[model samples]
Structures are given as C-alpha cells and as structure tokens.
Target: MPSPADKLRALLAQDKLHVMPCCFDALSARLIEQAGFGLTFMSGFAASASRIGQPDLGLMSYGEVLDQTRNIADAVRIPLLADGDTGYGNAMNVRRTVAGFAKAGAAAVMIEDQVAPKRCGHTPGKAVVAREEAFDRIRAANDAKAAGADILILARTDARHEHGLGEAIGRAAKFSELGADILFVEAPRTVQEMETICRELPGPKMANIVEGGETPDLPHKELEDLGFAIAAYPLTLMASAMKAMVHTLERLKSGQDRTADLMDFGELRERIGFNDYYEVSSRYETSRRD
Candidate 1:
C-alpha cells in the first residue's frame, strides 16, 4: 500500500489542490473512499466529540486515540492521516506516538506544537511550545519511525494565533528542515494570510477548511492555486450527522419522529450496508444441518 504520506507528497507535486474530508471511523472512511476521494483525514476534533463525548482538550490519551485510529484504518483501504495532539507530551512521547499509530495502520501522524492538554486548533486562546521543542518532537517522531518509510510525520503549528503567521511560517520552514514531510499551520483566519503562507512556506503544506470558524469557505481550486497540496474539510460528515441526530431526537420527543419524517428502514439499512448485514445474518441464522 502506498503510504498516505507518499500519496499526499505525490499529490502535492501535481497540478492542483487535493480535497481530503475528515473521517473518524471505518464506516466514514469507506464512504469517502467509495465516493472516490484520494485522501482522508482523522481529526482530533471529530475523534474526541464522537468517541468520548468531550472537548478536544488534551484529556484524551495516546492509547485512547490509538484505538480509534485502529478501527478507522481497519475499516478502509485508503491511506489515512491521524491527529496526534501534542504528541501526548514531549519528544519521548512522540516516539510511541509514531509507533502506536503505525501499528494501528495510520499512513501518517500529525503532531502539533501545543502544550499538554491540547485544544482544537480552531478553538480560541491556544498556545504553543518553543520552536526548538517542536523541532525535537518532529525529530523524535521521524527517528522512531526508523525507516518506516510508509509512515509519514506531519508537523502542525497552532502558533498562527499565538505567535503570528510569519512565525508560524518560520516554524514550518524549520520543521521541514527537521524532516517533517508535511506542515499544518492551523487556522489562518484570512485569505491574505493563507496566501502569504502558501507563498512563503518552502515544503509541503496542508490547510484546515472548517466551515463557520476561523476559516471561511474558499473554492478548492483557489486554495490549490495558493499552494495548499491537501485541504482537510474536518467535521463535515460528523457535524452534519450530529445535527441530524439532534433533529431526529427533537422530533421523537415531539412525537414527530416517525417513518414519514425518516427514511424507510430499507433505505437506512442500505446506507449502513444492511444488505451485507442480511447476507451474514442469513448464513448464521440457519442450523449446521440446514
């Protein structure tokens, strides 16, 4: 299998921006792959919200995230890049971060330059570690992979808000020097800042396209032109799903969540691979003699 990093790097070297929707599980990954996208991302925001019912605070551990990444990777055939928030603490922690995710079948792992108990990049009032500290973290991740060539090390900086965009770009440049394959400068609030970053950063770059947040929607083509090789639309599917779930629950509480308001069971089944469900159930339903 081509590593997600390899695929991403190859795509970056090409003519346009690649759209990678964020996927948190096997089902979503399979759906994205079936939809014919070449890239998929595992977002910390979605992971925490879906699995743990919590914020993207550093509260989630490496082991917890590892389990989720494993399930998602096993569920799909495509390369997946995962969020390793703050490397779970320091450079040493990053060694295990790479090893764990690689074992779980992640094609790439993204570690951010944030303090412990990391918050989502889009969330307000974020801070970052020193430049040298982030550099060491990347070095440790790279070294730990140990010619695990298929696995990629992505360096992300939340420094855009804390230290300014220029410093973030400078950090990205240094991260590239430290052997990071991809750079994620989290949350540029303006198109101009984004364009400046695109022009300034010397290595491969990834963009976070979060609707209704610090990032406004830009046509994928425009971002590609600006030099973002990959754009991760984090939280689209999960956010939409959550909205639907809330609406459905509200309808039910109001005695309106009926078949008329919902898709037929057959449709629901089809969407979740219910036909496959029947085939498996049928085989097991019959006795050995039958």
Candidate 2:
C-alpha cells in the first residue's frame, strides 16, 4: 500500500473537488475504501456517538480519538483525516495533538477554534476562543508534524454560529495566514453565504453537506463551482444504516423477519470480507501456537 502521504498528495492534486465519506471506525473505513472513496474522515460526532454511546458533548478523550485514527489507518489504504477537537487543549496542546495524530498515521487532523468540552459545530450555544489565541493554535499545528509523517492540518472555525458569515470568513482568512492547509467554516446558512466565503478567502476550502443541518443542500455542480477543494457528505451512510438496523429489529420483534426475507448470508460474508479479515487475524494466533 502507498504511504498516507502518497495518497494525500494525490488527493491534493485533483483539479476537481475531492469528496470523502466520513467514517467512524475501521469497519466503516474499510467499506468506504472498497466502495471507491479516495479519502475517509474520522468524524467527531460519529466517533463520540459510537465510542461513548452518547451525543457529541466533548466526552471523547484525546487518546480515544487517536486510537480510532490508528485503527482506521491500519484497516484502509486510503488517506484518513481525523478530527482533533480543540487540539486537545491550548496552543501548546495543539502542538502535541498534531504530533500524536501524525504518529497515529493520519493524513490530516482538523482542529477547531473552540474551548475544551466544546459542543458540536451545528449545535446552538457555541462559543469561540479569542481570535489571536486561536490563530496561535494553527501555527503550532503547522509546526508539529512528526518526522516524515506528511500530516495535513485542517483549520475549522465555529465562528459562524456566534458570530456571522463575515466573521467566519475573517477567521478563515486568518487561519489561512497561519498556515492551515484547509479551511472548514462551519454552518453557512445560505448559498449566497457559501459563495461569499469561496470568493473572499484565499482558501483551500472544505464544504460540509450534512442532512438537516444549517447548510442548505445544493447540487454537486453548484458546490464545485463555489471553489471548494474537498466536500464531505457525512451522516448519510450512518443514518441509512441505523434506519435499516432499527427496521430489521422491529420486524424481528413482529416475527416477520426470516431467512427468506434477509439478504443472503453468503452475499453479506463476501461484502464484509470475512475471509480476508480472518486471514490477517489468524497470523498472530497461529504464530503463538507454533
């Protein structure tokens, strides 16, 4: 497999906007790569939801996120970008957080300008740190790449909620000045606001199209026309999966679910790659017995 840097370089070279399906764990990451996605993101909301069995309320720890990053990195050949929430602390913490994710074999780490225990970007009652202090975090992240790790740094601004579109754009510009490789401005409410950000910032921008969020849905061609470098459709896969699982459970309770109604076991086994997975998993066990 090519190195993470090798894959990331290809992602950066694309003339069109690259799209990554956000994944929460190794199984999802593997499936995404097999499904032909060039990149995958370790989504903070999904990670917290899956890992802690709760909402994304800053409950997940730094080490836990890194562990998820490493697991996904090990399981897939494509580039993985993990969310580094608030860089795990202040500007100094941002330095260590960058190195930690790089050492974990991630291609990119996204840190927001928010205080610890921060809420989800789309959630209300959000707050941001002082602009000057937050920019320092970006500098530390740019400076803290592990040796030969080619890790990417994504600067995310949550200023769009408390502040306005103009403030978000201003912060994005400053983050770009502080050497952020990509700028993610959270929650643009309208297409005009989106277009303004694209035109205003000297940015390598990332667009988020989450269903039922603050961002209004636009066509792929429209998003591409707005100068986005990368776009992510997070939550769609998980939401669909969750709905199917719940419906299956309901059917089972009603005694309507049966082998005939279920998908073929063989087909599922093939899709999940059970044979290939066991082949890799068996090596250590067989060696130990030997």
- TM-scores, all candidates, are 0.90, 0.92
lDDT of 1 by residue, 123-167 (tens): 876789888898899899888777563588888988888888889
lDDT of 2 at 279: 71
Best by TM-score: 2
Error of 1 at 164 (Å): 0.8
TM-score of candidate 1 on Cα atoms, chains taken together: 0.90
List residue ranges in candidate 2 displaced over 4 A: 146-149, 258-263, 277-290
TM-score of 2: 0.92
Question: What value does the lDDT take at residue 11 in candidate 1?
Answer: 66
Candidate 1 residue spans exceeding 4 A from truth: 1-10, 147-149, 260-264, 274-290
